[model samples]
Target: MLTPGDGGAGPAVPVGTRGPTVQTLATGEVFAALDASPRGLASADAAARRDRFGPNELPPAGRRGLWQDLVGQFTDLFAVVLLVASAITFLAYGLQKPQDVGTLQLAVAILGVVVLNAAIGFAQEYSAERTAESLQAMVPHTCRVLRDGERRELPARELVPGDVVVLEAGDAVPADCRLVEAHEVSVNNAALTGESDAVGRTGDPVAAGPVLQARNCVFMGTDVVAGAAKAVVFATGAATEFGGIFRLAAAAPRQKTPLQRQVASMARRVAGTALAIGAALFAVRVPAGQSFVETFVFALGVMVALVPEGLPATLSVSLAIGVRRMARRHALVKQLLAVEALGSTTVVCTDKTGTLTQAEMTVVQVWAGGAPHAVSGVGYAPEGDVANPQPVRGLLRAAALCCNARLVPPSDRQGWRVLGDTTEGALLVAAAKAGLDRVTEEAAAPRVAEYPFDSVRKLMSTVHGDTADGYHAYVKGAPQELLARSTSIDWGGERRPLTEELRAAVTAANDELASQGLRVLAAAWRPVSDSRPVQDEVESELTLLGLVGMLDPPRPEVSDAVAACRRARIRIIMVTGDHPLTAEAVARRVGIVSRPAPTVVTGARLDALDDKDLDTLLAAPGELLLCRVSPEHKMRVVTALQRRGEVVAVTGDGANDAPALKHADIGVAMGASGTDVAREAAVIVLLDDSFASIAAAVKLGRSVYQNIRKFLVYVFSSNIG
Candidate 1:
């Protein structure tokens, strides 16, 4: 846990115009003047640190010393029996005798191995402190802040409450603050909240605090996804960042995973039984007038026979092997315990945005007039042939010209890549599928004008010059917005009258596409007056294009991954924040839910359920998806699942996911796209971030668990003999 001493408030440096300034976050109260003051803010920072840390705040309890730590780590029954036997052998029959030399050397070897095991285990467990340090490294060492109307670079640690900080794209927030002003700013609070897309920021004071979006609030440790703004620092360091949870989390002793706890319990029982047998032997033989030496040797032999000294070593080796195997399969194991933990996982909570679906979105559905056109393929690959190729050149031209993102050829033509948002990329791919060769055709007919896509409008417009005729504008976005503006529809068969009835039919088609787990995008276009630029006069869409459908499409190997979990008796629960329909659709595709009446638990309903209902609901098969669940709800679900003797592994990559990630027996996070905070908290990180990777990880985990079990069995049998 961090105190003010560790990268907290230090001496403040003077900031020139556009420099750091201190003011209250909500009230705009000036805690310290902005003009020409260096020590002034420093004094305030010192005071804040004192108030936060305080003299009354106690330090964590000191840990055992190296020797004591080793001994304490091996507090298992097996170790205790060995220690007792060694003491008896030394006291009774001296180690100097020839016969005793063999026994003594063996005893010495056992002690050496035991101490080595303890040392290694303790070292590995304590290495997580370095992970914390690594996390702290993610924070920018220095930040440019506005003080006395001048911008100056100062250590980010010096930032105190109420300091106004300038933000730009890619800058990790220096401290937590409420936005005083913003212009087209959006923060990716995915680190703090699990929301996938960037949240739009505004200067307006949040009217409803209940719905806590990072829109108006700039939080520490969160990066600006796009745009720029100024915000007053309300919190800093541990207090400002994720509500000082890091400190609490770091200080909290790393609890043994449920499997570890169970193994430890079993090990202790085995050790106890061995000791009891040795004690009984000593008691029975000693009273028969046998010498202390004879009785001691007899007991010592019995103890050695029962104690499984190599069990810990064998378990460690198995885990190491499992980790290596997983790494070979592209799933890096951060914590060794995670390998075993995956074997015992009962529920796997995964994120929807990037984990289950490709992070890159594409236009899957095109709503043109009264017709629905399904776009083929998932992601940026342009190899897949369109299911229904449209022969009309104008419709293809509209889709190509109307989109913002363009497909670029990689080094190889077969390896096509996109240079835009997943949604826009999807459109480009769809345009390509429509037989509009964007790379060659767009070059020939060049884009004359274009308007970038924005959230508020939710549509992108582009005009192409020299496209057979004069100019055409293709528009793709929300169906409701496009339908409201459209004047007519082209029903491939004929130019049909687009009435309210027809519009509802189009809407239903889009809904049907969505119900099947395809993200549907409505595409429309108009032949506008080429005299004016495309942006100025692009609002009136004359034709409604066909609807396009998209799905992340399941990983090819996920089916087998799910089947493997089933074979191991692990129940797979997909917990996500996606719509129930969408999540259910994906689950069904992955073979998680085959039945039609699959039970789905929503976040709101979960909150209302008592423990009893929650427990009963978990056992119900066919219900694999929990949709729109809050972080707290996830924690509850994980805990409840665990209470029912099911091992839970939660996979997530957002700040809201932190609590459940910490609560679960093992937490897995996406390595590539996951936020640093999420990775820091998770036990395992999926480097490839594929469900297939997780499946492979689970297999490795199971192998590790089996090896541990095998060692236990071997040790027990050898001892009994």
Candidate 2:
């Protein structure tokens, strides 16, 4: 438990029976509150601290001892060989007298050198863990909360349950709390969930009660990216869900890298072989009347040769080279062992938004009445064309004129422009291609009023045109919402009354697009009287326009990257939270399809497969696509993949992406726009968020592994010789 107080290092008062006592390191004022009383606060801070930090002064104990750890290093074959040699040399030449001093000095020198090497190697390998401690320090230093019925600044750790905390943009939430009030509040839970987008929250109670969705619950260790909120703390300390997760992550043993495992095994083998040879030499020589001391010295020399003292240096250099290569591709590799893990990756689970798509979107399809037009290109670029042809251009003109969105001139990227919103920009561009200038259209049918999109309504309506010309409006959003309002259809490329049959037909078309992995949005329009403005009423008598399909287009270079992985005998599984069609579409575009076209499994389908069944399915010899998988299920998929002896690389930047990233053999986070928590937990950061960079990182990893192998062989042969 933590306590918040003045920044001055003086004293702190512990609250409740379970609260922890704290004292200022400088002033030595102890504070322990049996109850909120003056007498309780009068206690010396020094006494309180002594009762706390002192009692916890001793570090936790665990498996293995310091002496054992030190001894283990000497168990290596080379160390054993050297020890035997030293013993024999000591026995052969007496070092107790001046005459034998020269021989004694030589023996001591060899022993000293071997011991020094062993000490240095052990120290380098056994350094204490500091990463998690450093990360914990990053928690917010201050928190805003109500005290004495007024908002005030307090130390974050002092936050208690039921306390009302104030949050603002960019502020890290100090504790787990239930939102009481919110204003445009959006929290980025990516650290906990692996979701790239910030989830909008409200004061209303969220579902998934008690264990409320982290999306709505302002969790400790998360940050508010935009707007302000007021929340009551429901939990803190180890009781917080994230705290438990952290404990698990911290307690998880640092898994050994493949190279490390191989080296340790080799060390055992060398030790065994040296022991065998030493015994044979000693037994044969002592009976043959040869000096037992001479035979022992030879065995020691053999051990030194077998140790391959330079192998560790070689392995370090190879991994360092790999790290440098990855850095060139904008990938920051943390542990040297990560390079080895990347080389063995058989599955790469990547994020959808920024990883696969540009995250820069554009309106591509527009429909009004029976007219449908296609808008070209994406991003802020103005280099795309509209494919409306002749008659459809008028509808496109209406879409542009009926909205208030605009394109700002680009400061860079010549022949390019940025839009207010991607969907609106699409209309503006479509209007431009139809020979309708956005400037002229805005002037003719100015947006007199507008309603922004909302989750419940699922529609954003813009009202335009003069009262005399009828209140013309354009709406675009989810298909279900649009379908409810639409009463007519545009069939045979013409507007017609929308009956149940027409709605069914349009729904089928939308379904087709969805099946093809297209994110479909429906558009519609209606003319109304200005005097009776009702945005809700606008939905029931609309004409179904057309459907648009958008994709997080695969990078042009991803095809080559996938091919490289395939050639290296690594299986690539495209795991995404996006719709199955969408995930499948991107997979196919990136050459992820099996020769017969891989099977696409939805989250529901994946959940139905038990671990045993999953193993069988994975081993069936073909590619499998898992789509719309939740974070928990994703972790399971990774576990399943690894259980099949496949090394996995899970790449993402969202909060929802965290679990799988943690579970994979290697977690690659996108540095740009990636949450600090994701970066902390990931082994590698793709600074460029490019799939190409991932491929480059993998290639470098393989190279490092190859070098390690070369060093191992060299060490083995030289040691044996």
Candidate 3:
């Protein structure tokens, strides 16, 4: 059970127990159930539990031996037919009165072709699975834990149930655990859930749901991007959510490509025609005074000759050339068969962030002192400006001071990176644009304490010491929440009462920014009694400062790419974890949604749909946007599209995307930001993580299909002649 600190990690409390029910209980109750204390489990108890439960690591999946994989490469129909022809040729040479050297040479050449193709094919496939080899690297190796009333660092795999684990910013969560104490903890679940946004976690009891959605819980492989927490380990190893999903992704069978199906059809037809002609020769020759044995042998020779011995080799070479071409265009084709399958793609199910839009967050507008101000710049470079940086100076300063993200300057090998949450990073960048360096600001009024943001409060505040007016507390959060906490407004450089009209004005400004596809957050501050005021006391009597809106802008080249897809008669559908409004806004900006009203389905609504309902929804769409989707929902969408005979090409970036990537006809993954699990399942990896590369790949694939047809035409013509 996911009992906070209740129940041992031993056989008494196995993984996969009803986590939500256990997590919904109070921390003290869970502690009683686990026989654990706030200080942590006694070392003796932990060691005893460890003896019953296995190590806190996922079980390794069985893999095909290298020799087995190599053997499989030679077992296809084309290779088998060529092998049979080579054997027959050798047999015929032996039966000849005098063995012909040219016949022996012909047999060797055919065998060589089969061996060479097998070697090349095996090598290519082996290289593609490199990501799988490093799957264990996803989890952190060491973590800090409390035992016997003392804190210590230990290998994460050694952690047992009932252990109180300490988590801080930048650490990967070692196991599934319920938080006992959370301080402004926000986790980046994108590695497991594909939700690009970092969500706040809390220690308070919440409604029962999926363990991953449990407000007080964190799962394995996710990153603690901000704040800190103390949680009790409940599930580990194969019992964890990450491990369960990993197995699902591994178990998903690979779909046969279009080329494979066509080759099989060609093989069947060729075999039938060869048999018909052979029987016809045998029937006529035996009756025309020829020896039965001689006629039979001659007919067999003709049949063997009918086999297209060079087809497999030629196709492999052509596809290899196409792979090289796609690589040069920033699309790495891992599966050779997917080259032709990409050409047959009828629908493109793509991601929103990093795929169609720039993943970097940029502050576009700032509302301060009752005036809207514009900030220029696009990324984390800290090279933009806020016009007349006087009125919004307080807003910018609060945004910078109340944030945890750090900006790394451009280095020799890499460009600037936000290094933390994108939203916080954008705030820091906005402050930098106004010549208010975070390093300098922190020095003037160093931060003393902070009340970290929690799911319930929806607000975060930090207290800074040495302020001219005693101590100052800066707060930033949802506009409505911050405004409700305020008693006054900083309007036109004058402190004014936050009247009903002023509140409406702020709300109207927030709506205007939301309508523009920007994520808006309001800022407020108030002088405090001391450096460490209670959250309840400091948050009241506050001056509502202003609002800041940031956006993850659409990529500059995406419009043309979307146009190209439309011209090619391929459907583009957006599947993301964003809100419906945000999803529709971005969808419209990128030309995916052209009509004024498009079909936007949320994950909750999708969960209620059956197969027929889902089909109707997909079929009734002008432009489809599937928002707030979990990994399972994304996979279902791809499965539904495929059931309708639509050749699906899906793009993914997270570990949860692995199954969907594996199931699609053409699985395109982002190499730059994608998880190892996703890259392992994908057939194609976009090296540059750009949607334009996918379009280029589709064009390249069509060219490869044309090449295949040309070769078929040439071969058929020669055979007829």
Candidate 4:
């Protein structure tokens, strides 16, 4: 239970008490719980709720002031030791019978070294913080809400729980809300879930499971891509899921990297050993009647000599150089110490989309006419060879006709650009690659009506006028839905009644494609008496055209990167929000999981396991995959791995991935596709969002450790002289 301060602008709502339960309850029940109505809250009641609930803005991330940052630079243990030694040198010089010029020179030099060290560290820290501030720039906005039966545009900050907000295509959802009424509403949850697909929402209530998967709800930070809906706001500000993630990210404590801990330990040991040796000399000489001023000066000189005067500057310079080299490889290091940590990384927990996979969806296989045909080529390019295109032409043509996406020819600056949905664009590109142009298909069977895909039916249909007098409808959607509506099949260039056996075969085919991690869609068609307003009946008793399976292919360089990680003895484990089959397939494709069937854990199963059980599973030798996991699950896994002395690195590109990114020893974020929340939480941002960059960074980081060792030897040898 989160409240206003989750990250947003107002007073935080009381924990577990203020959030209204909207998803599980009936619409009427929800309205009663919030004391809301279709007409909306009366002006007086709305004012009171606003006052009680605080502002609707998420709390801003706290930033350290320049003064605070500078103060921190001087607080390092090494710097403190040098400062103390410098002060004592001045005291010893003053107490001497005759002022020693050499002692005065030593004190001035130590002060100068301390100042120089502080300056270098402060510059880098300030620069990194300034860059982060650029990423945090935000703007306030407005939303359309109904108040006392009148719809008005108000600041998004003014939105309160129980406000009925009208969502249209292209409008950002103002708050987390339960749908009261929906008309083909579809939302893009990419910001919140990291999945780019448009998910359909309904006004129906669901009794159980995660609210993230609730069909009756729409959440903040999501954009309405199609249709319209009236949803009642239930959560706002930090209380919303969007705000909750950033809150967790900000709240998660980042531990000191191994290198940082080791450096502090070394500094303490060196300072302590030098002081002990100097103290023994003073104790032995004092009994022999040596002057106090003489012994004090001698002890202070020994301490100064033992200290690594140039080490701080050299180390900062070395790490800064590593940052530059990593940038060339497409990784930006936000934390200077992360360079050393990357080299020591033993376990990498990565997300599926944008890291290992190219994230560009392409059609690879088509099942039609009782035979399977493989489509060649990659991305949105319509330049693939379709094996036996003539047999599958009908399926491709009908699928193209039913889609609303358009493809723009390749321009000098960019490749083909998809105007509408990427899934539909894939269908259009598939048709073109098979020599079935969209214009040609449309002219032959011009569409007169369309039924957009919705959460309920899970299918979209378009009624088209064919060469014959009657109208024909082309439909494409979830394979199961289309299969249930289908009564006949296009069997190898011939029409046949779909027998029970044939239906079972079709079901098997769909399952086979899905198990291979392909996004499968079924195509079907039916003849209608007239091209009047399209209705649900128009999709019934259709002819099953077959299925097309698409995949977000793994990047060409990921395999080599995986091999590099293996050679480095870094265990790569995939943790994704995708389905288990999809996660495993991508894991195998990228070489994260080599086993034929790995021990895959779903989020639900993970939730049931205690810490000891989780640790046992993770310690097992076989390939491990976790799918359908939430941010908490990811963070939990990172913690479990760390408990076994593994230095973990987690990669992510969505708001949901923020907490894990913050909690991990190394958080690598995708700069291009990652949400701002994710980027803010990560210490390393990959410009190309490639697993290869991470491998490259680790290589460069390993060199830093060698550089440190070399610097230590040189300093020790120089001090001996």
Q: Would you list the clashing residue pairs of candidate 4?
A: 7-58, 7-59, 8-57, 8-58, 8-59, 9-57, 9-58, 369-492
- TM-score of candidate 4 relative to the true fold: 0.87
Indicate the residue-level lDDT of 199 in model 4: 82
Clashes of each: 37, 27, 4, 8
Instruction: State TM-scores per candidate.
Output: 0.77, 0.70, 0.89, 0.87
Best by TM-score: 3
The 0-to-1 C-alpha lDDT of every candidate, in the order given, reads: 0.64, 0.62, 0.82, 0.83
Best by the lDDT measure: 4
In model 2, where is the ten-residue run with the lowest total lDDT? 22-31
lDDT per residue (tens digit) for residues 1-721 in model 4:
2233465454555343233345777788777766689988778877877886766767766867778877887888877887887888888788776888888898898888888777776776667656655654542368999998999999998888878999886578888888989877777776677564578788888766677778889888777766688988887787788888888898899878888888789889888988888898888887889887788777767767877777877778888889889978978788788998998899999888878886667888999866789998877878878998998999999899988767888876456756556688788889988998789778878889998886578899999997766788889999999888888999987889999999989988888888787899999988888888457668898999999998888888999999999999999888888767777888887888786779999999999999999999999988898988888999999999999999999998888899999999999998866777788888888878888999999999999989998999999888656
The per-residue C-alpha lDDT of model 1 at residue 396 equals 55
Write model 1 residue lDDT over 493-571, tens digit each, in one string: 3666678898888888878887787766666777777835646468674577666676666655677777776776777
Backbone clashes in model 3, listed as residue pairs: 6-33, 6-34, 7-33, 7-34
Give the Å shift of residue 173 in candidate 1: 5.7
lDDT of 4 at 293: 71
lDDT winner between candidates 2 and 3: 3
Per-residue CA lDDT of model 2 for 1-721, tens digit only, reads 3344334322222233121211111111111222221121222542343333222111222436768867876675545555655664565455232346655665676576567656654453343123323433443378887754667787766665545678887577886666666765676564554343456777654334334353446787666765677776545654465554544443433445556566667767766776677677777777887765566655554544444555544655677667778778887776666888888777787776667666544555554444456667665455576674565555565556544456676554233443233445555665565577777666777777777565688677777776458677777778888887777766656778878777777777777767656667777777866734687755558766666555545666778878887887777777776656566676777788846577778788888988998888777877777776776777788778777777788887755566667777888877765544455557777767777888887788888787777767776776566
Q: How far is candidate 1 from the true structure (C-alpha RMSD, Å)?
A: 6.6
